[model samples]
Target: MTEDHLDIKTPEYVAIQFQIAGLGSRAAAFIIDQALLMIINILAIVILFFVMDGMETSPFFLTESTFPIAVVVIGLFVLNWGYFFFFEFFSGGRTLGKRMVGIRVIQENGHSITLLSSFIRNLVRLIDSLPTAYFLGIIMIFFHPKHKRLGDLVAGTIVVHERKAKKKKKLTPIEKEINLRGLTENDLELDDWTLKSFTAKDWKLVSTYASRFHQLPVEERNQLTKQIADLLLTKKGIEVAGKTDTDLENTLLVLYLVLKDEWEFEL
Candidate 1:
């Protein structure tokens, strides 16, 4: 895709927007669920209180009077925590809220979230919801472009909207050769770089500058051409010592041929 045709929004920002929407949807769902749970708990407590009131046991005994209430409250708390944790942690990176909002969480590098990730993320909710609310986490998400909560930042995870249509480009023979012989996507898996490095926008910039080379002075055009070639060589994991302008042009030509799916070009 050409640069003009591509959306240049940073992935992190995009992720933030998706997360915000998802969070809103989730908050609404949580309120409803909690409301229902609260009513049930209230009714249970009332019933237990009345049933105990009619018993012959003394009302002054702390064990019988307070213990049952404590147990019920603790049980309810545990049940709520377990339900939220299990769903968010194990069910494809989304909770009931996330699923309703059409977004899912994944590792920063687009991998599936692990059990550890889920646990840490949910566990941190305690911190995120500190001092009464999740004010800390909300502050982080609001200020940061990636909308990452404290747990997400620590876990190196991101929440993104699920894209239904991912673009796929066919590789040319020369491109194939470089990928097959030099570095496949799996081979150059560097820690800092992401698929975004070779975004469609970068490709468009290179293509435009390359095609308009003749409009500039020969030396300048040659210099630009060399840069393009170096990019291609680096992308392919090819090493060329003391490469000349002509050599770079040759590499770029090969890249162009590959992008065009014309495998018959000479080096």
Candidate 2:
């Protein structure tokens, strides 16, 4: 089956739309954070003035005031930016915006976002925000296929939709058998997308159509199956063995095992 027939409920389109919405939400959060920092800075200045007013006779007031004002400015900057970078980089794979918008940053391999990755991603935010107004980042997102901003492209990160609910089901006995069958040349006869890059939706589609394989003419089915087997062998970097159907089945099983192992370890 083609990708279109997989009944994908979470295509890249949906993911990209979610990301665009998330940007707006995140921008709002940044504004709120800045406003809060400004309020704090104002309070600090007012407190500093009162303390100095109370210390009537001190020439040291000027010296002390300079240091405190400098400290307050530096502290505000750190507090304003540091809290977000620390939490987003080292804690959960989200900031307040991401959490609110139901998206998460993850590694390219689909693992949880790591501390180093987070730091690399956020540290480059300044670059992403370059040319004084984040114009570069906006242009990149507008043009790039994945809508990646500068930080995302640099850090090998992407944001995806959080699955809303758990899928509850056990593999059927036959399904379990199929999964365990291992890779064989016959499996290569399946669609390239199915054998090489089956997503969750692809697996569902395969399960739906597998029982109908006999509907095709015998010769046609054989040709398609052989094509799949050849592709599978190529993917495995294995020499093709001219063999019987059973041998082809076994080879397909081996390919399946390899792909399964890679997928599990990646996640």
Candidate 3:
């Protein structure tokens, strides 16, 4: 791990690294959150004003009561404070703004943000936002090696870029076959109506096909794939005019995913 990155090992013994978010991205996410909160507050105030004005109660009730205004002020304060805690805890460290910016908070150990960690971080946000507009937080992030603010340091948490599982791993053979011709599950999916027509015998035949798919001689695979594809698909009005070996294999695999739930089959 370096100053700009955080590294941790999982229980599975796999090491992972996360790019630490710096001032610019964090500021962008904060601005989005503040804008959302401002909109909510303005709408709430407007709605309350209208409700009070339209009430059947006497004008004196509206004019005399400071209680309603106090309640609104306190409620907004709680809303602001709880917003980060609620989202970070329940949404696994991502708020709406964080998700939009493709960054999220996580424990220093690369675990999901725990309830206590979320609460501690959000509690210290008061200090981070002090003296107006997060000035102190900005300074800390600029100087800190890991780009950590007071809240992050106190809570032992860090913000990082989102991880993409499929992009990080080498392509598996099944995945390669599916992607070979840009074919999606939609292209191979059978409707419930058609799926219901399949009987035990059809499953047995498909099981045999799946079991022998990898063992076939490369020269004979396409020919055998065409024959099986014709028997299963063409009879059901599926157009297999120009599908290649990969396309046919992908179609069979998609079927196996569903049928294997109820029937045992070896791949």
lDDT of candidate 1 at residue 22, scale 0 to 100: 37
lDDT of 2 by residue, 75-118 (tens): 87777566656766665666655676666677665567777777
lDDT of 3 at 135: 92
- Deviating ranges (above 4 Å) for candidate 2: 1-58, 167-267
Top of the candidates by TM-score? 3
**CA lDDT of each candidate?**
0.61, 0.59, 0.81
What is the C-alpha lDDT profile of model 1 across 114-146, one tens digit per residue? 888877887777788776667887777666666
Best by lDDT: 3
Provide backbone clash counts, one per model.
0, 15, 0
Q: Which ranges in model 1 have alpha carbons more than 4 Å from their true place?
A: 1-26, 29-33, 36-47, 54-63, 164-267
Pitting candidate 1 against candidate 2, the one with the higher TM-score is 2
Candidate 3 TM-score to native: 0.61
lDDT-sorted candidate list, best first: 3, 1, 2
| lDDT of predicted model 2 | 0.59
TM-score, cand. 1: 0.46
Worst 10 residues of 3 by lDDT: 258-267
Residue-level lDDT tens digits of model 3 in 1-267: 343777899999999999888888888888898899999999889977876666537775765566677778899999999998999899989988899998999999998999998999999999998898889999999889989899999999999988866667786555465466565555556778887776667677776776776678977877877887898878766677788887777777666555655465433
